[model samples]
Target: MNIPFYKMHGIGNDFVVIDNSVNSISLNKRRVKALCDRRYGIGCDQLIVLSNPKNDLADVYVQFFNGNGDEAGACGNGSRCVIAWLYRKYHRTEFILQTNAGLLPAQVIDSQMVKVNMGQPRTKWRDIPLKHEADTLYLPLAGEPSAVSIGNPHVTFFVEDLSTVDPVFCGKVLEKDPLFVEGANISFVQMLDRQAMRVRVWERGSGLTLACGSGACASVVNAVRRGLADRHCQVKMDGGNLIIDWDAENNEVLMTGPTSFSYQGSFDLDHYPL
Candidate 1:
């Protein structure tokens, strides 16, 4: 079957967005992994499906799967890219998307930027869903990581320099740490100042990417909880900068960043074996 798709990205975290509004689309594990393969298939950090909303509260139902074919609860960057696509096609700026995490309200600021209200940060060991009960503020682990969940679980380590840390080695170790029952996206963060920070993330299923929206949001929230940064901060990643604000009053996270369309095309599902 020929499936139409849009190739887009927010910062450097790209996605293959498939519109399933008109036709029902189904993807299996092998197909998802193949589609994410850079050399053999349409490359992307995640595969997004836009379906007709089941509930009246949302404009559409957005689902995200990582390169490994695992469905993630939330994807901030992917949501922004979806907003960009919806805006381009519908000429509408605001949208309510229901994701696996929950309802996310998004806005297209302009051609280059989009903003998403990422809802509240989940702070408790049980919420982060760690294996044992402990302080989320200061997880009793190596590097003294702080745990936070912005729809997805994350463990942020405050480091002096992000470059010095081995993302692959550390990520492989910490992502499977016994403390995190569901595993976790691992991030190394450096505080530049009260309003700026540098971050690098090893996403749980996607491995390392140019950027990670949920990781950025969780990092800022963790930093703020630790009194390391202001409620609003600029998170600098390898791909680009994302403005992550932990709204003090509303207790929600607002992420603003740029998104771009690389191209648009169609893929044949028959080309790949199930």
Candidate 2:
């Protein structure tokens, strides 16, 4: 089967987006992983599939799969790119995006930038879905990481020096730790001040990407909960920066960042069968 796709990115976290509203494009784990292989296929950090909304309130339904072929509940940057695609199709500035995480209200801030309401952060043990109950603000683990769930789970370690923490090593260990029933996205955060911070993310299945959108939102929420950052702060990642606002008025996390389309094309699944 030949699949049409749009290659897009938010900051530097890229995705292969396929619209399935017109024609259903089914993918299995192996095929999804193969499509994300840099040498063998259309490489990207994740694959985004868009289809007609299952819920009446949403404009479209979006699903995200990491390069490793694991489906994720929420993707901050992926949602932005999806919104950008929708804007080109409908010429609309705002709409509701439905995902496993829920309905996210998205908006177009400008030509290059987009914003989305990512809902409130989930801070309880059951919400983060830890295997065992532990204080989310200060887990009884090494590095005293904080847990926050925007849609997926995240464990953030506040560090004084970003260079000292090995994201791949630490992230791998903590991601699969027994503490987190569902593997967690690990972030090493360094506070520049109350209004700004630097972050490096080891995404659950994508490894260390240039940026992780939900990781950034989790970082800000964790920082504010720990009294290390303001409600609104700037999170700088390797790809670029994102403005994350943990809105006090509505308890929603608002993320604003730039999204771009790299190209668009079709690939035959038979050519690279994994």
| Model 1, global lDDT | 0.92
All-Cα superposition RMSD per candidate: 0.9, 1.0
lDDT of each candidate versus the true structure: 0.92, 0.94
7-112 per-residue lDDT for model 2 (tens digits): 9999899999998887686678898999898988889999999999999999999999998899999999999999999999999999999999999999999988
- Candidate 2 residue pairs in clash (backbone atoms < 3 Å): none
Regions more than 4 Å wrong, model 1 = none
lDDT of 1 by residue, 1-274 (tens): 7888999998899999999896576778888899999999999999998999987999999999999898889999999999999998899999999998899999889888999999999998898999889999889987888999999999999999877999999898889888888889999999999899999999998999999999999999999999999998999999999999888889999999999999999988788778
